[model samples]
Target chain A: MQDNYQQKILGIIGGGQLGRMVIQSAINYNIDIHILDPDENAPCRHICHDFSHGKLTDYDTVYAFGKGCDVITIEIENVNTEALEQLAKEGKKVFPQPEIIRLIQDKREQKQFYKENNIPTADFILTDSKADVLANADFLPAVNKLGKEGYDGRGVQVLKSEEDLDKAFEAPGLLEKLIDFDKEIAVIVSRNEHGELVAFPPVECAFHPTANLVEFLFAPAQISDEIGEEAIKVAKDVIIKLDMIGILAVEMFVTKSGEILVNEIAPRPHNSGHHTIEANFTSQFEQHLRAVMGMPLGNTGLRMPAAMVNLLGEDGFTGDAVVEGMDEAMKEKGIFIHLYGKKITKPFRKMGHVTILEENVEALKAKALKVKDSIKIKA
Target chain B: MQDNYQQKILGIIGGGQLGRMVIQSAINYNIDIHILDPDENAPCRHICHDFSHGKLTDYDTVYAFGKGCDVITIEIENVNTEALEQLAKEGKKVFPQPEIIRLIQDKREQKQFYKENNIPTADFILTDSKADVLANADFLPAVNKLGKEGYDGRGVQVLKSEEDLDKAFEAPGLLEKLIDFDKEIAVIVSRNEHGELVAFPPVECAFHPTANLVEFLFAPAQISDEIGEEAIKVAKDVIIKLDMIGILAVEMFVTKSGEILVNEIAPRPHNSGHHTIEANFTSQFEQHLRAVMGMPLGNTGLRMPAAMVNLLGEDGFTGDAVVEGMDEAMKEKGIFIHLYGKKITKPFRKMGHVTILEENVEALKAKALKVKDSIKIKA
Candidate 1:
């Protein structure tokens, strides 16, 4: 088994920071990792065993890259799934499966998946264009989401009233009911080819006021036992239903009346699980590797309560990255800083993250906020 | 401070497993690491930011490597100190200062320094040749050690009696009286240029019956509080006395009568502290980086009891490496395996290590032994 693992060449489709971190874990197994990304200077370029500069969505490029790999995976979800499907047909192992990737590539399909599968989620209406969104003014107070190519905070708009309909996407999209929730939480679940599945404890996310990205996260979310269990069950069910083999991050909203609603899901290691690196028995990166490699899932128990803070570039910086107050943050105990090897900083760009561990959730939150306030990424 | 850290490039003298692990930690800081080693295919070659294929002991190679680095350190102490001394004179920060490296490179000088500083250590006499060792016939049952170029379990022999004298070293070396100790423990301590010092809890080591290298290690060594405290104090004192500005591992013997005697010392991360990667708040690899970077020492508190088992190559095999029973070992919980990227296997070679974490020492020990017995490396 070990010889087979060593001989297997694992190819990752995106050579960003996530791929870089996964390669870091892969090194422990002595597994050769090949990376494909358009950026020649991607963070994973220097560390990966092999690197090919090409478009992740280019059919020929993706097919050629997968030819030499015994098993193929991805750090990002925007890669060409058609090529992966062909590779799968040719006997190469493509984890998370190409069909599932195709289903997740469009918001319309994702929302439809939840509804058809009887998964609890907010009500939504499919829209062909801005005209279709404007036709149904009754769903005025909904979120307009582009069906494809929408990432981060882009291609999303709050259509709270008729006047706001101008913000609706001009392309195919959906109008999802705006959920009034008590909190935003995420649960990461992983499944292996052998049918083994495991879920990391749920974590509550606090979004940046205007950036539309997670700013702080507390593990073992401050939710009721029933809610946490429900979140895990829902997450596990989604993966099992998709029959996907790998890690998935399921984001949800806990409404004020105690209803759990699915918000979004990522079919790979997510920002929500970054704290696992230092606070859990097994890091999510390692768990992803094991799941895809068909190895037994690791113990997902928490070593200690942990809080994670994303280190985003300051609003006004747009040149070579400069980290401020790192010294002060390091002076605090139980603080682990991870800076992505990105040389430049732009407003709200994810430059790195910090994980804070404590004996209790309260202390972890306090330390996490303090660390967030102290460290700044600037030009 | 962060800018200074980012701009600074770290040069390490050895590109083996130790340097590879260090580079793994250094990557988190986005710090550029340049590695120098004789083997072109050294384990650290790919991951490091820069790699130079050259002799570490060659003054020109070492000097040229140091010229591009803002800070110079070593993963192995066999580097040419003269080059480091010159680099230090020219304003490069050479951690574990050249003078201290020189002092530790020879076993004779190490023993003498321990005695001069009133540090508790086994008594020993410097010997220039085999004749000098034979002159003291009454010093039977002593251990003869080569003064220089000795590493791992090499360049040492047991002089149990006149018949064993033939195994004594013939070059400049030392004859040390061996102690009948109840347990062998090691403490890893780190000091920064700012005079800050911190020590990890001592860990007990069990050497292989024939390999002479550590076979298994248990953290928070099952020793009395007094002995543990004494061991820590002795380790800290050695670093302070030497005024070294980097991490050091001090191996000591705990006599049955409760006396603590220093056995030897290593200037870089040692095998005994490998368990810290998963069991302690701060891993030894990261701690070494923090100490040499002049950053504040992190919390070295133990999160739980842990045991580390060194993965050694099986005897009677020498060829392309093949690992056996890894699948069975991964079936167990709380097992973290780290396989160094060495393609070939030789009898007794350090192949990798497994760190086992448990709620209690008894369970940790049981799991560790089971893991040790299950995993095998062969060719």
Candidate 2:
């Protein structure tokens, strides 16, 4: 246990908005936070106590950064797991463990783990070679995911016919039949090393079709209690199976037939839970720090209904980012805007987010739409 | 108006908890915050864009700190107002303008302004010398306030008769007839440059008699709606009369007969409204930044009932501060703790605070007591 607050230094792997917010909470506790990100202008630089500009996937970089920290955690999954494994072997506290990251990093391994653990996820076939999937005709009209390095929409393709099968390459991957789903939801759960677990209320997330990025999120999703409970149960089950020790965000699909299928998991604070910062009793960022630091998990209760709108970079403008129509959006009540300190803007890059809270979810959604339309991220 | 976020650098005069929290909110807006305080380890140091260690009371120090900033503000009112006056004269946007700070720095002037503006405050008589107070013996059994440098309890004394009047010193001061008050309450009010005003719900504070420090504070002030409304009205009246920008925390006393009297006011984020950080849609710190930056104020609506317990340094333990029984307090649900990064623990120093939320105000109060009993701040 940490004897002095000054000695409680936490090392974070990524330096994006997640890391930035974690540092925000860490400061409240007087915890020293250090970040390792290749970008010198990472969003977290100004807030963190220390910054080491190095590739998160570089073994030496990750190991050196973790050496002086009391506990090591990640804000992103694509990190040097081997270095984390080495650190854990030396008795350093690495939350979610290097092994868990290895499982979640690969779509094939993640799906196999869910099946082996009897967790309800989408049915999929993992193949060692992509040629097997292309030659076999059974996996038509499927979603093809590269085994590794499959970020947002970059490595996932929808293959509807034999002609579209050419998208597959000679790499290990997974093929899953697409299911008609009514909605997408996520449950952000956290567990400490002592096994105390807590989950925020499930939030429904809407994604942009072309960008494959979350456009908006609504807390306490406008769904039946039964569906919300089922989604939370799936999320809790996944955490327990993986023995996750920090924040585990579980995204799942609610099928038209009332079944919940686990989609993916992020072993850190996720975008879907951003509304908690304004509308919940405990923010996910604060909770994540509590869990990783071996402190008691905070109460996860919604204080009000809330919706989150993403601020994505405009398509035609790229250079230094500028947020337009902020004053106009500020005129609306219950609207809170956050602009990530990113110097450059590219098409579809996440610049910031806006959270709107109201007693009625519908009214909140309406106000959220208005905010989304008024604010534009450009350069 | 600032066309780009990067150019919106905000300079804060005090680097204490209020300044630290303002930076916490300022980061979300991507605004650069620079703080000036004599202590290099000031709480705002780690998170701010820039830090200059210098006495806030020194005119040259404050002026030099404000020279490169677009706007200047304060977390504490003890700074050099002349520097702020010069900054304002040179086209810098100084919130709660230096003229207002000058008026608030002295009790005699503050009360006179209240009288001139028809604001409701305890009746008082301004005196230039200590002998005048003694000459008018009918002002017996009154409260004597030192005109300047009078902190929470240090410079105030109650005299019952001429025998006890010797405590009065030769300085500009005020003597006010003491009233039998039922409770102490405060309302945190905010105003933008455009005259738009917003107020958080009134909060009741319980004080430590010997220390003259707040022990705990309850939001929505467990008072009749009529009394609550009166408190808010007086607060709003004071804010408008001061022509205040940023946040104005009005502390008032409610007499046994249900009459309200403004006691004192602070022109910045205050301890009384700290509960709003967790229980209201907009925190006082965030609201202060928004108002000062010319943004529309956020929704000042309650999300839940909350109580705040102050964590003061334990008596006779004056080394590095150590918080004891934190784990025990964390066992209670809805209890949030904050520790200011003060390296040393002096007796009765304001180290940090804890916020408790519950549907039942009485239950919350009960839990608050338990938490208070369980936690100890020592060296």
Candidate 3:
């Protein structure tokens, strides 16, 4: 949408659910938006002031799209960083700044950056082929993972035995000894361009044993307050190091003795912070907008005790999505449902999520799980 | 996107911010959504599973759009109800149903329904047209209004004198005598298809002096507790008579001696209830979702004292939109902004709004007005 006036339009690449969410934040802040995504039906399409369907990884497409806005940001990391880098050189504010994105995009380089920056991470060996790690027999128990495009348990395998590596999908992947953890936790922190930073209470994440998808999450994690603080500190450290100008979720493993180790980094609103939409004073969605738009970061205090349970596609139901038990689930008090509006749901596909907020966290958790079990994404 | 799915899909007509909000609610109960709007880029486009772009009043468009959806509901009343009625005969569920919609769509019919049902309203004379209304000049100091397509301060005009009546835009309208009101109030209620009803606390609305837009709204209205209870009773009475399914907002006037008179009815979410997004335990958005999905209504408790301030386009600002004082406003605490992603701004166009949640209501009220004045919506 061209105008004679020059409004500060924020360009977003990738218009999936996260982009849809990010655009909501931008809208709240009255920031003009331009989105570039390959899907004409991308989630952020309607919410943006202007949207163009194009490839995020096509340099020319991305560059041309980026040139139309005052700043460029992304909901997903699999983008053409070279084009973003060029725009950064041309003075457009590209956040997670192209340099930072460059470091995080490749697993090998990301691992090296962690090591060089003295960030705590699982010990890993970068190898050209799966056989390289398999040949080192002692390291056979490690988890083999290709860093790029690995999400929701995809691009990851547990090499419990040497044969597991023989059936691997890719060559160049990271081999890291899986660490035993008492709990998995993640902290979402926001940093503005002026270097001001704020962190929400660390949230404990419980993964579905098989799906490896976050089954449920709790804010101010049901751990020692001290451990939660440590997680927040680790998250802040990561964002400061990256000079991130928006939200970054730092996923970590809590050792049996309560030591915190960074598991991975996501440079946008992470699934871990979804509870904020109902439970926090200023939701993570609104906070991300404030951070990137250079507005003051909002208070990250929890407004009420809350629990979030993922509403995944039920196993064996694939043709279309149907969430049964919602009739009974909605009867439960204080439950808030967030469906992603996906028309079809394959087995274990992310369909939507439910958030239960009440003063009593214990009670809410029980109800949340029932909500999780009751709703079925079946055909 | 076609599949053999038996589950119901709720067809919502109109994709304005209100529809976008209702979409949030529908998603909560794991309900299927298909929106019809003339603008391809209406706010709820990506959020609903499927969207059809066409005029709401076009019979073919409305009928075809409602063909597959199991039930039809409107986010706005300016729809082709005859088509909905036809679809209903073929067994589609149209909530608040087409019968109710037809009655409410015209001012004359609405006033007649209120009188027939013994519901209280301002004294009104329904006119056949502008000529008919002007022909009856015995009623001076009257509120002139067109029955349909009038929203957010449109459709209604005050005819105080011969000059006022002559100067008023001539069309099919009404002449209702103005009342001496102490304050303006609105109550939002949600009812299920089964006719169960839940009423929220009546909210006090302050209007923009010139634009006739709701400038601010505070819930748990300033009236005495007894009056507030009575307000809820009156609202429930109206909904029961209307047999409104899903959410309905009943706007009212509080006369000088404390008499509450019904002002108007909105079948969907109302701007006056915007405070629920921040202050209430279950936002009207979530409640609307619950009502339509047949989910249990959430607890309707206010979490904090809150106020909503609309962000209207500044006069003379055309072509593009920009919000000023956001940086300074952000510096202060407890202010939440919500901007509609409209590409252009015309004078008095509702660009967006802000909801302030504070512990201290008096202090919050003062701050709200300051923040409201500080904002400038100009290109």
Best by TM-score: 1
Using TM-score as the measure, name the better of candidate 2 and candidate 3.
2
For residues B154-243, what per-residue lDDT tens digits would candidate 2 score against the true structure? 788887788988888678898988877899999999999888998898999999878888898998787899999988899998988787
Q: Write the per-residue lDDT of candidate 2 for residues A1-379, one digit (tens) a residue.
A: 3335456789999999999988888877889999999999999988888999999999999999999898999998899999999999998899978999998899889998989998888888876566877876477888888899987567787777788878775688888878778999999999998889899999999998888889989988878999998888989999998988999999999999889999888999989999988788789999999898988888888888999998999888899887888887766667888888999999999899999988887788889899988888888
- Candidate 3: Cα lDDT at B368: 86
Q: How much is B365 displaced in model 3, in angstroms?
A: 0.7
Q: Write the per-residue lDDT of candidate 3 for residues B284-365, one digit (tens) a residue.
A: 8778766765556776778878889888998888976766777666665667777665767899998878888888879888
lDDT minimum window of 10 residues, candidate 1 chain A: A1-10
Docking class of 2: medium
Q: RMSD of model 1, in Å?
A: 1.4
lDDT of 1 by residue, A1-379 (tens): 4546888999999998888888889889988999999998888888888889999999999999999999999888899999999999999999989999888889899999999999999999999998999998898689999999887767778888898988888899999998978999999999999899999999999998777889999987999999999999999999988899999999999999888899999999899999998888888999999999887788888878899999999998899989989887776778889988888889999999999988877777778889988999999
Off by over 4 Å in 1: A1-3, B1-3
DockQ of 3: 0.32
Candidate 3 stretches with Cα past 4 Å from truth are A1-13, A27-70, A90-92, A122-149, A155-178, A293-296, B1-15, B24-70, B75-84, B90-92, B122-151, B154-179, B255-258, B289-299, B315-319
TM-score (0 to 1) for chain B of model 3: 0.93
Query: If ranked by TM-score, best first, what sequence of candidates would result?
Result: 1, 2, 3
Task: Tell me chain A's TM-score in each of the predictions.
Answer: 0.98, 0.96, 0.94
- What TM-score does candidate 2 reach? 0.96
